[model samples]
Every structure is written in structure tokens, then in C-alpha cells.
Target: MTDHPYNEMPRSDDNQSLFRPVAVGGRGLPGNLALAPMAGATDGVFRAICREQGASLTCTELVSARGIRHDPGWARSWRYLAITPAEQPVAIQLFGADPDDFDYAVRAVLEHPVLSSAFAIDINMVCPVPKVVGTGAGSALMRDLPLAARVIRSAVAAASGYEVPVTVKFRTGWDAATADTPAFARMAEQSGAAMLMVHARTRDMMYAGQADWSVIARVKAAVSVPVFGNGDVRDGPSAVAMLRETGADGAAIGRGALGNPWVFAHAAAALRGEAPLPPPDVAARAQTALREVRERAANLGEARGVRESRKSLLWYLHGTPRAAETRRRAAVVESLKEVERLLADWESSFFDKNGAVHFT
Candidate 1:
């Protein structure tokens, strides 16, 4: 492991406590660990698994406010906003450039029977993708503070009537030269955001480069609202370091949580000043992967679910023996049965004459 201080395990006497409940408006999260909203990776099944695995809060993937306004029946957005009862305290994240669309979208969410019960309404200003940024939404809003304030005001106003909190997630700035996250935090808080989450990279950096935790620290100092630090938080120590270094109220795990829902459990343990559970063995990884595939199959039919699960299946097999070949076979799996056969064969190879797992 690298000698970075953040990557070092925390000691029992490290004054930096990582776990705590955060109050966001009328709702209260049981702990500070949250699953950051990811566009395609965090499906309903994965969200539920993360919740079960110890994520105190979860967020739906980014949904388009304009799409919600156009499809009031939720015909097109249901897949992204689908939150099961098991994933309670989930937030529905909406992204759009227009304040009017956010106003309508927040109202629409509050009116829906199932969605009305969400823990909070999260607004996305952190996504750095081209399509989203090209439309003056996502991180593009960072360049226009006035418009960003208006959008937050619109969402907060709409959700206030239902006693639901509004949260904003954003990058540090449009680029390194214009890094003004503290100012952005103040604007969001003044605009009535109940909570703020900072992904410490600039729009130009996208997902590359080291996230500057100093920005998150500045943001926490700038706003009274709870601040959650996201980016590069891969495990317990990094989560703790984010809290320790930034004084953030929480740590939000994004790519770190893919195929490894146990990250939440490990984070929780570290927050409690305890040793994290050992990493899952190959059997455990395969089992969880199968469970996710089965649940997805049950929800979205076998053919589609298995097809969609290809990437996740590959993630589960990462670092294992013959991973390249296994991933190659997994890439084109079109049915649940095919996945099962592939996993069974792959798993069996790990066993010896004694039926015990033996890694070479």
C-alpha cells in the first residue's frame, strides 16, 4: 500500500471519530456512511444490497428533471428512481439546468405515492460527463453560480411543503483555476440546501487526479449545513481520513462500492475504532454476484438482467486467477443460466481434491 497518511489504518486513540447520525431537515440518517448516486451502477437491487451491507443512506441514480416534467407518469424514469422498501432513507437525485424543471420535478416526486417517502431530494451538480455538461447542467452549473442558486431554491421550495430536505452534490469548480467550492457551498446553503456533498475534483479533471480534501474542508467551514466528502474513499481508512481531514459530516462512497457492498460494513467498523472485517473470499464474491444477478433477473427478466449484469460480473472476478478469460466469457453472457454455468465452472476451479479452496 502507498504511504499516504489517509491510506494508513486509524488507531484507537485517533481523535477523529467517523461515525455519527446526521440530521437533514426533518429526516435523520442513522449513520454517516452513504452510497453516492451513480448513473448506471447503482440499480435498485444494488442499492438494497448496499443498505443491507451497512450503508446508512443510499441515493438513486441521477434522473433528468426535464424528463420527469415531460413524463409525469414516470414511464421513462422509473428504472433510475426505483427504490425498494429495503433501501429506506434513499434520496432521489435529479439533474437539469432549468430552475422551472427542478421546481416541477421536485413537486412531482413529492406527489408520487412511493417516491414521496424518500429521505431527501438530492440535486446533481457534480456529474462531469459531456452530455450532461453540454446542456448547462451537471458541473456546467459551477460556472454560473446565480443559476445554480436558482435551481437549488426551486428544488428546496418545492420539497419544503412536504417536509422533505433538499441536498446538493457538486464538484469543486469548473476547473482548477476557478476552484471556489467554499463560495459554492455558501450559495447552496443560502439557497436552502439542507446538506451539501462535495466531490473534490474539478469538472476538467473528471474522475482522474487526486481529490483535494482541502476543498471539502473549506466547504465544511463555509456552510452550517452538513457536508459529505466524496471521491477516492475506497475503504475504512480513507473514509475516516476524509472525515478527519475535511471535518465533513459524512463520507460518500462512489466507485469504491461497485461489486463490493461490504465496503460500507468495513467503513462502519473503522468508524467505531474497530478492525474492519476481512475482505470477502472468492466464494463470497461469487455468491454475492450470483445473488445480484438473480435479483436483477427477477426484477427485469432473465435476458435483460443477465446482459446488464455483465460489467458487474467482471468486477466481481477482478484479481482472481484467469480473470481475463473469465471476463471474456462473462462479457457476452445473454441468459441467467449461462451466468450460473460460467460462475459454477469458475468457482469449481478454485477447489482441489479436498473440496477446499486453493488459490495459486
Candidate 2:
């Protein structure tokens, strides 16, 4: 609602005219709101929802560069790279530090004809999880600037024949005490990265304290490529606040979009000076949950998807009226049919008179 420098940017449509794109690469990205590459959470199905909800840009979950090279099954993991024509301008995110391995992975992604339609391919250098960094991939690459720069230059060169731009997503640093976000962002820009996404927290923070918008602002100031400020953007107003405060060209939404993909549309609307709506009603919420579950099941298959979806299903139900009770009921669901049955019976009671999730 507040008109600030960040809120002042014109909202552009999807690739229609010469209007500046959201500036993902050296050019505009078309859609300003981007979906962050959450490991298990940002799969193809969920990405479809966020795209439908008005996210102009979306990224695949972080894929291992090493896996993409060593394992034939690696292509299977790239299932998240599956994109329909509707969701154009998607970015497939990859991780790993080995220059040779990264070169191979870049070639692998480019070989797929379907992936050519993407706006760009992003390298992830900002994951904090031990499993990822322990392999010297993800945010670990940040500590080794020479290797990180080499990876980007090499990936870009390998994918040079293709038109898709190459970008990087990274953290502030390992921790607050050793923050290198400002310096590294500049380095990536210098090394030919098309765009830079600053998560605004050091790896150590790991979604802990508030995302340092100031650092995001600093990165934006330091880099010429469009800098997308991420973290703590849980709703429309927060998106506006970050945009205004940091003057970032765009925002990358993560955990906030967990059970609420509508955030993309709402954020787009708010940036254009529109009113934000309340969270969806119980029926709508249930429908969304059902769709998400069904899609996950379809992608991952019923048995595995059902089991893997349990935690997300719980996240979707969080803060709903009788959510605890409903989740308790949902916990026993052993199959897709059971999940649907439980949701059907309990949808109505989830919304209170005030139109919020009921606690009881």
C-alpha cells in the first residue's frame, strides 16, 4: 500500500512488448515474482500452482551437478525440470562446485529440447543444509570464490550455444560473522552471471533470524544485474516492504508459499497497487490441498507421494480451525482415497466465523 522506490516499478506482462522484463538475466525476466528453489517443496506440481497463481518466474529444486554427471538416474531427478508451455521463463536450478562436473550438467540440461524454452538456468550457491554444503556444493561454493566464478564461467560457456541465460542463487555468507554476500554478489555479476538472487541470510542463520534486507539492499547497490531479494517475504505486505526497503528489482518467495501459492498473484497485485485478499476460505483451501496432494501423488506415485506428502499436508492445514484435530485425523490416512475422505469430511469445520483457521 505504501508507495516507495521499491513499490514504484511498473509491473510488466509476460513477454508481450519491449517493456523491461523483471531483469533475471542481463535483460528483463517478464514476471517479477520468482519462486525460490526449495529442495523437496518446489517440485513440478507445486510449481504449476505458483505459475497459475501469477508467478511469472519459477525455479526447479536444487539438483546435484555431480549426480547429473555420474548417474544415469540423474535425469530422473530432473523430473522437476518438466515444464508445460504455460509456465514459460522457468529457471532450472543446479548445484555443485566441480568445474568439469558443472560443465557436464549444463550440457545435460541444454540437451533436452523442452528445457530450451526456459528464460535461464540458475546455479545454487546458497543452500545451508549439511548434506548439500558438506559435498562442497550449494553455499559452500561461496567460500571458494575462484571455484564459484569458474563454475559460472564454465557453465555459461558450455551452454553458450543455447539462448538461455545463466544465473546464480546464493546466501550472504556462512554466517553473520563472515558475511560475504555483498562481495560475492559483485563477483558473480563480474563473472557473467545474468542475475543474482540474495537470500539475505548467512547459511548459519538457516531461516533463523529476520532476513537482513539491508544486505539485500547492499547487493542491489553493488550489482548491475537484477537482484531479487529473498527471505521473510511471507505475504503481500511483506513483499511490498522488502521491495520498498531494499529497492530490489524483484522478490523470490519461499517457505511463505508453502501451502499458499496465491502469494504470487497477490504480490503481483500489491506491487501494482491492488488490495490483498484474505486467505482462501475452507472450501477453497481444501480444494487447493486436494489438488496439491493429487498432483504430488501423480508425480511421485500414490504410495511414495502419499508418504512424502504427509509433512506438506500438515503444513497446508496449519493455522486452520480444528487443524490440529484435522491433522490428527489426516495422520492415519494410508492412501489417496483415505486422504480425500478425510479432507471431504472436515473441510467445513476448518474455517471459523471470522474466516480464519480455527484453533480448536
lDDT comparing candidate 2 with the true structure: 0.78
Badly placed stretches (over 4 Å) of model 2 are 1-20, 26-28, 73-76, 350-360
What lDDT would each prediction earn against the true structure? Answer: 0.89, 0.78
TM-score of 1: 0.94
Model 1 ranges off by over 4 Å: 1-16
Clashes of each: 0, 9
Candidate 1 residue lDDT tens string, 1-360: 234222233344665566888888777899999999887789989999999999999999999999999985778998887777999889999999999999999998899889998999999999999999999999999999999999999999999999999999999999988878999989999999999999999999999999999998888877778888999998999988888877788899999999889999999999878877898887788889999999999999999999889989988887788677889999999988889888988888888889887762
lDDT of 2 at 356: 81
For every candidate in turn, the CA RMSD to the true structure comes to: 4.5, 4.9
**Which residue pairs in candidate 1 collide?**
none
Per-residue accuracy of model 2 over 173-203 as CA lDDT, tens digit each: 9877777787898789888888888998889
